[model samples]
Target: MDFAFSEEQEMLRSQARSFVTDRFGAERVAQLAETEAGWDESSWDAMTELGWMGLSIPEEQGGAGFGFLEEAVLFEELGYGLYPGPYFSTVALARRALDGAPEQLKRLASGGSRLTLAWIEGGRAKLLPETGMSTQAQESGDGWTLTGEKHLVPDASAATDVVVVAAGPEGLGLWVARCEDAKIEMDPTMDRTRRLGRIIFDGTPAEQVAGAGDVRSTLERVQMTAYAALALEAVGAGQAAFELAADHVKTREQFGKPIGAYQAVSHQVVDSYIGIELARSLAYWAAWCVAEGDERAPMAAAAAKSFAGEAAVASCERAIQVHGGIGFTYEHPLHRYYKRAQWIDSFDGFGSVQRASVATALLGS
Candidate 1:
């Protein structure tokens, strides 16, 4: 079996890398981090022109007609560049949940609107906190109204619509609420490059996209895809950090010799490399499994997410240590990568949560 990416996938990867490297460099990311929108509108327009938002949707649906593998390739490049935008929340999370809503999907594919999933409730620090969700969707005269508070909504301020999971007459379901109706307050976080918003809905009008019977399956699919994408992104960041640290060690001298000549620095770099490579392999495997709808996809995603998240954080920390005092300064780009790794590591759920899921699958829970 061929484990390498196909020629076409390689081309896609190269193209994405070129665009991200040229347009979304460290300085550009830093500048965007200071903005209220947290992204450049012109650059986002360029990405829409490039058809990145529709990479995984079917051609019939006005997308690139590719699979999750192709999306994985693009996300990896985005992660490497640390592109400060809602691409992950919009494309990876919101788009997946909008499968049943053609009009919303069309808007997303055209980049005419930005949407984000609002599932985290009560400021809970976990993924898919369904049981703890207090959001209620009450049936009204021809529509629904949502009343509750959602915390840590990714890019909520930038989103035009929110895909919210709320309990209704039929039970738990998915609803699309217009952001204009919801009270949104942007919050400051360690990862300045990304934005998180606290959203409050008070009898907000919404459109149901999925009923109770179908909500679980849809959410599961979205969760798996999110895990795969985030894992791949983590791997990309880890690889970049490793490369940077390796280069630093090779040139920086200590005791009249390159620090890389010493066993200690070389060993740390080598360990980081090994971790990144292992994480990459798992990330790719998870993406392929999700794309192919394999039976082991859940396990694969859990394992990939668990390991890759930690590995990426470790790689960033090691890079910082290897760079010595300079790495600790805020001016260094290493801090940005480290912050991103930390953010991704904690997003959805921490490594421990994913590892527990994998353990349950293996041990027969």
Candidate 2:
């Protein structure tokens, strides 16, 4: 099938690329790595001004009136740039949940408000929540109280609203918590580019959005979005990493000849290039599924995440080796991409998770 973008989509992609390139380019990611926070709020505002922050929201609520395809196109650009921000948190993934909340969605799209969802604890969920939760309707004369702690809340530090998940007496569900009424505390995290912290709740308040039946459905969709977004990022990182490797091999000489001329290094560069293209293909297929509402999107998403994650990490490692000692240095740009690649690959699903997901899809059990 032809994967070429629609004319409007291509225009959207071109506009987003120019905007991001001009606003948050490579140097910007390096600068953010120095600071404790991930996003350049001004750049984010620029995205909002470009209507990118509202890419998937309904135009009726002051948004761009687009959906997954638009998001995927923009994400490919984000990956290419290795943008160090919470675009995934605020826009691509959580916006769907916010779409359920009219007021919050409108505020987020039009008012420069930020929204994030806290589902997995520590990082991506390899399993389920430990010491999960059970809901109780505490009888207050006026209302009730909710108490639960969600660890490793992403981009919650500066967020205007957080969508929190909890297991109630009936089943697993989620609710929205405002930082003001709900006890939220943030701190610096390993991935300084993405804001993460632990959220505390002491009779902390919430606004329920989904119940048992649809909660997991919604959550799964969000996870797919996360996988899709991060996978695209890996594609970007992988492409950059491979380029770095190839460029070094072509120029870096040893024994009076370019290292790329040697069979060993030449083969390595070739391998990296192949992996990047194959993973890119899978990722784009997943994006297409998401945009078209294909059922295969979920499994295809898992496959894409698996492939991209593996590729990003492997490509970075190989690229580092291609750069020799320089690649290991703090000053080298390779290290920046390397670290980011490592961190992002570890998100959504690790190697094994994706493998099993692929297996589950391929085998009829």
Candidate 3:
């Protein structure tokens, strides 16, 4: 299939880039990171007002009526700016899960409610935790009661509702449960920018909508959404790191010449350039798959996430390397980009996991 983004998609990309650039420059993002909340409320509100938070929502639900490709572009801009918020967890995975939940679409689309997916368990990384969840989704007169614990729920401390992926008597349905009633507790994280919470649901109220089909089938769809958003975010962060490094190389001097003149530094900068462009291609393509409703979106998103996530991490590392001793310090912006990329890698298995997923797709189970 042809991989070019249509003019309309390009327009959307430009608009989103402009919005993020104007809203969260290096200084401003740094400023926001220092706050107790570690997220920029003003910028988050601006994104919601611009319909970015619900870009994929249908117009009937008071959204932009756009599709996934457009959303991918916006997310790349967020990554580029390192826009701190629950944009990834709240907008990407939670929204899709809620779409399958009974009567939750209206609340979610209106931004009157927000949700986070809780799948992370303790000390598990580099791959999805295989530990069986303990959540009980037993039938009730009204609906269902969810009782269990989910650790490392992004933004759950402030969410209105949470989409709990649990084993139910019938099958796996994205169970929607009230957040305030769930007895969630916040925990400190390495990033310290995005809040993490551990939630305990003691017969908490829930509404379950059986997925379009089986549990695994529904989860693939959910993962595609997450992978696509991470790809876009990678594109943003990689490009930002490259820009910062490039400017520094031109201005910083060594041996009576700008560092850009040195082959050692110039080559790394060029590599970063290539990495960003390659990652960008994969991200946009994955986004197109989602918008066009192609069945191959899962694989496409995996490819994009793997490549872009790696590229972002590598680019930030090179940025710090090129910045000399100052890059190692906490005061440098390179560290910020570096930490962001590390979080992305740790949270979503690095490109290695995607590579394995791709291999599985090609070779079959």
User: TM-score for every candidate vs. truth?
Assistant: 0.97, 0.90, 0.91
Order the candidates by lDDT, highest first.
Answer: 1, 3, 2
- Greater lDDT among 2 and 3 belongs to 3
Ten-residue region with minimum lDDT total, candidate 1:
123-132
Each prediction's Cα lDDT score? Answer: 0.87, 0.74, 0.77
* Candidate 2 per-residue C-alpha lDDT over 199-266 given as tens digits, one digit per residue, 9 for 90 to 100: 77667666677666777677777777777777888888788889889999999989999999998888
Index of the highest-lDDT prediction: 1
Indicate the worst ten consecutive residues by lDDT in candidate 2: 134-143
Q: Write the per-residue lDDT of candidate 1 for residues 1-365, one digit (tens) a residue.
A: 66889999999899999998899888888888878878886776788888988887777778888889989998888999998878888877888888888887777788888888888876554555455358999999999999999889988887888999888887888899999999999989888877798899999999999888888888888888889989998998888899999999999998999999999899999999999999999999999999899999988998998888899999999999999999999888898888888888887778998888898998977
Q: What root-mean-square deviation over C-alphas does model 1 reach?
A: 1.4
